[model samples]
Target: MPGPAPRVVFLGLDGATEAVLRPAFERGWMPNLEALWDRSATGTLWSSEPMVTPVAWTSFLTGCNPPTHGIHEFHAIDPAARTIIPNHAGRIRVPTLWDAISESGREVVSLGLPMTYPPPDVRGIVVAGSDAPGLQWAFAQCPEFGEEIFRDLPGYSHKVLWKRRPRTLDELRSVSLRNREVFRAQAGAAERADARCDWSAMMVHFHNLDGIQHRLWPYLDLDETAAHQPEWTAEVVACLRELDEAVGRLLELASRRDAAVIALSDHGFGPCRALVDVNGLLCRAGLQRRLPYGTRLSYRLSRIRDRFDRWKRRRSPEGTSRRGPRSIEGEVGCDWSRTAAFAPFGQLCGSIFLNEDLVSGSSAAGRTIGEIIDALRAAEDPDTGLPLFADAFDVAERYNLDPAAEGLPDVLAPSTDGYQAMAKWAPFSRSLLRPDPNLPATHRYDGVIAIDAPGVSPDTRLDAELPDVAPTALALLGQAVPEFMEGRILDEAFDRDEASIGTAATGGPGIRPARRPIG
Candidate 1:
């Protein structure tokens, strides 16, 4: 009889770092994860520069860098259009792991995978996560995937539970509890579908750990006077422990057969308090101009929108802001010259794309722009004293840099901890960060990684090539890793005892194969 085809399952914990999980697991906070770690070979999964969600997860899934996949930050740039496009839908140009599997006639289910706004044409169920406005519309663009399946799931909202309300001590605890339950429900639904399907690959993502870590990190000082507060330490542990229990539930649902179960996070988390407005800094650097008084700009035309929203909302119309209050316009266009950069989330640090029309007369302007970005990266703040930014890079490494790709930023900025860059059209932004003496929350870059499965090798590190995840999965499934895949297949994680899977025309370390661009 033929050997059973391997089944694969991936659980992505956004912002889960070893920093928190290590201590939490030591205290028995994550028993199931600990069990998985005990059985599996695990190591740190390092991320690319600007180590944020959209880029890291996209790289993992597509086996390509931000340039090749067309996602740098949570936002993407169309160089020709000179516009900042959000990384909604599968705008990635490379094929994802699920797409490869489906092509081979295997089934796959993807839930809450970032940048999967327009769900791709997969062989199985897909529920795109990350609330992009055009999520349903993007899915509709794909004629292959059943639009009905996309409709059944909730729209791509970043965090349903944590963002339900702002961070309050009570709200934090409640969100933690509610998040565990919600994750359980979602995982259960996916597992039920798994049972009915003949062959399957499913990815489930949880964002609560990252959310809790964001708010609770500063309060985590072990030697503090408030150390005993559950909200400080015990409460944090409880949240992680609850996530552990949810993991246990899912493990129970999966078959013990040659099924490959892997638990991973996109990147770790760290502490962030005040947002550093990079645009304000760039304005000081002579990179951005300010809006002159009495000048009309699309983004500046917000007063009219505000008035209209307020006037219509007084009637309590059916379609308006879900939470009733003074209405705010969703978006505004900008006088690009007056804006240096904008921070989208706590992660996006800066935008250094050049203005073609503005600098058309300058000699070798792109090269000069590169020099400016390099200097900004090495700069430091004078007062509070932090790196001007944590990391900065150009898209040349991975992106082909199409001449027609407009609005492509020349540089990407990730601020030092406790800082963020903001774009113009921002209402209340500071030129520099001030000491927010009262705020208690923080952001951290250290997170957790635990692997539990029979196929994994002990003491293995998969960070050598960040793109190895997809090839690693294909290896376990006994499929070949295609050539033209920029990443190396993780051979260390697999053992000699495992029978050889079929080899791709380009399988193995440091091998590139011919592959077509994904539309």
Candidate 2:
């Protein structure tokens, strides 16, 4: 007979990267993280192809690629309904880590995990993150837990207002501070829950780091000779220090429960130099249709009105407000009937959708796709003569996509730079590529991951990918790794016998006949 299984605690820091954390750790700004890295196996956790939050985290949870998990991007388009639905847990086709662990008779508590909105019916407690519109329906197993959180913590928010751009440094500081406070409260709540409940695994996610990087990347990445240095840099540093403290607290909690600790991020972060309007290019190629003359006139007038309104707001005593930028789709409506191919907005990639109605047959659609791909490949920056897109993928060939999947895009357009591909079909005064003043930071491919467990080798450097995390975690819990999962366990990070404990099982959720004993 084997002893009891070790509890596992996963701390997900959104957009955490070695580029930021390495410097902070070396400067002694993050002692807890430094200590964990010193004693644990640390490595770069590669993100998904487009490296968006939803897709990467989904890959982390499912041990499967985007195709198997069925989450290719943030927004899934419904062609028949002509609507875009936000990705959520309901969209996940495979069983997640939480489901497997809970089914093995271990209690799990997940707090503030993204893409978990409309929380699944697990054997344990789950509180959804950003996708939930309100705090009321954030929790699935425990409604009172959310109520207690709201009542206890003042200015408690499950998700920060990421879309809103700060007009002033003070406004940015205010938002960052509020989000930091919310993270602190959530971390404290997670610690308490772990202490009270009989949980085998507890996962907590923090989004403030990602928010701060997005809003203050200009200041954070500045040199001493920069033209203007905002006073809010100190606040950003303070928020990071607070995050470090939260890690320390969680580490202590994990220690008390005799749990192994794993700290990781879904994706990395970097400065976004410019935005590429892929839809505008499509319009130029005559692939995307233009609005009617009357509609175009109305749109021009609306833009004038909007500019006037913004000018008035800037001149007002209050100065500019923090309203988010309007969606390009809403601004320039797509004429689907005449359009052949159109790129839809995503975080760091634009998914090009072919209009099936416009292209009658499959052969014609293939020809249109080939033409669009050729055109995009031929496109070059007039100023630098550089390729606009880093890579373009045929969805069906690259991802082994299900041909029958609804709302699937035809092509994926990832920008050469880390900027988002904007879907703007209308012509504008600026060049095709221009600096996005509103959003200065975006995601990168190399995320951060650190694992510290008993019997695991110390000071080890492991090479890992996003999908590998789920199976490694399952192996830690002595659960069988599903054969359908595409990732392999990190044998280098653990002792020989421990690493070999996982058995590959086929079939679905009911395939696990019995839980393996903890080695």
Candidate 1's residue-wise lDDT over 1-519, tens digit each? Answer: 022237777878777776666666787778888778777767777665556677778878887766667666666544533334456545677888888889999888776666676667777766666543334433443324334334443322235455432357676666666665656655655665565565556777776666665556654553231235555465566666667776776677554545677777776655444555555555556665545545555444555665576567546633333222221112323355544333322344565555555566446566646665766686676665678577776544334574225334566666665554444325445446543333333333333344444445666654443566676677667666755456655545545466333232234432344232222
Off by over 4 Å in 2: 1-5, 162-165, 222-230, 296-332, 335-337, 382-386, 402-404, 424-430, 496-519
- Total clashing residue pairs per candidate? 47, 0
Q: TM-scores of the models, in the given order? A: 0.79, 0.86
What is the Cα-based TM-score of model 2?
0.86
Encode model 2's per-residue lDDT on 276-393: one tens digit a residue.
Answer: 7787777777888767555566556656665676677667764542222332344455566778887656656767888777887878978887877777776677767777777776
Which stretch of 10 consecutive residues in model 1 shows the poorest summed lDDT? 321-330
Displacement of residue 89 (Cα, Å) in model 1 is 2.6
Worst 10 residues of 2 by lDDT: 510-519
